[model samples]
Target: MPHSIKRIFTWIFWIFVLWAIFTSPNRAADLVLTIWEIILNGFNAIAVFFDRLLGG
Candidate 1:
């Protein structure tokens, strides 16, 4: 993307995040937890795949 568009998006993202944090902290926390769970699940799946591939 263009630099100007990237900056605009970055600003918008932070603004939304700040708005979420201040307006609905509980929901924000839940969102973060959900994202973390997704990341961990992805890693676990990758590890399992590698283990199976290596016959371990």
Candidate 2:
């Protein structure tokens, strides 16, 4: 990707982040929590899979 395009995307991302922070902070926080939960659940699933594979 071109440098200009990268900068544009970075600016857009920051703008969106600031917008989320300034507007409906509670909802933004909930979104973060939901994403975190999804990541943790994925890790747990991977651990379970490995455990079963290893005959643990």
Top-lDDT structure, candidate number: 1
Instruction: Report, for all candidates in order, the number of backbone clashes.
Output: 0, 0
**For residues 1-56, what per-residue lDDT tens digits would candidate 1 score against the true structure?**
99999999999999999999999999999999999999999999999999999999
**TM-score for all models, in order of appearance:** 0.96, 0.92
**Each model's lDDT:** 1.00, 0.96
For model 2, give the 10-residue run with minimal summed lDDT: 21-30
